[model samples]
Target: MTKSTKPAAKKPAASKAAPKSSKAVAAPAPAEANKVAKTQIIDMVASATTLSKKQAAEAVSSMLDLIATALKDGKSVGLPGLGTLSVAATAERQGVRPGTSDKITIPAGKKVRFKVASTLKGTL
Candidate 1:
């Protein structure tokens, strides 16, 4: 009979499990934090404004359309509780292509900008 000469198995290295001393825990990402339902907004507007669901939807649509039109006309749109939407012109610039030293001219364009309201910023 062959005699077995094996060392006893050792416990896996201490798990990287956090030490219990620290009270801080990793926070959830901003996108995952405090999710609000679209239905809630619709319901609130319908109830508070005393408008039918269809009317509420139309009102919201009109507001958004107005904002879009203003921005298209080179005007800034500001909503008291929401934010400001504006169009900013980007200057043309030369950019280098990836994996190549060749330079390319990027055409100038107008881009929409959003500045969140101070109240909304605090909440986030």
Candidate 2:
């Protein structure tokens, strides 16, 4: 029989806990919620492509205008890899008034609906 001579591995040390503070907890500011605005998008597009900042801004604005125009004309917009944007009609329904049990009728309305593409959803 052969004798084993390998040394056993050492266990890793535990991490130290963070110290607690007595300061009052404040709600996070809205800007802290990771939001990207249009200007940032324009800049990114310009940098990624060969287009100038002005050209990039114009392109982005034009694309948005086209989408809005199509939606207004009762047409569904489909971007191959992105998704589809369409207007949905919602039926009238009953809703309860806040702070009271009184029932109220909600009028039917049209709302924009986005259906994410399976390809995009799968990537996430």
Q: Would you estimate the TM-scores of all the predictions?
A: 0.59, 0.72
Q: What is the C-alpha lDDT of each candidate?
A: 0.77, 0.83
- Model 2 C-alpha lDDT per residue in residues 1-124, reported as the tens digit of each score: 1233222222222222222222223334455558888999999999999999999999999999999999988899999999999999999999999999899999999899999999999999
Worst 10 residues of 1 by lDDT: 5-14
Q: Pick the candidate with the highest lDDT.
A: 2
Instruction: State the lDDT at 105 in candidate 1.
Output: 96
Best by TM-score: 2
* Model 1 bad stretches (over 4 Å): 1-44, 98-102
Please report, as a residue range, the 10-residue window in candidate 2 with the lowest summed lDDT.
7-16
Clashes of each: 0, 0
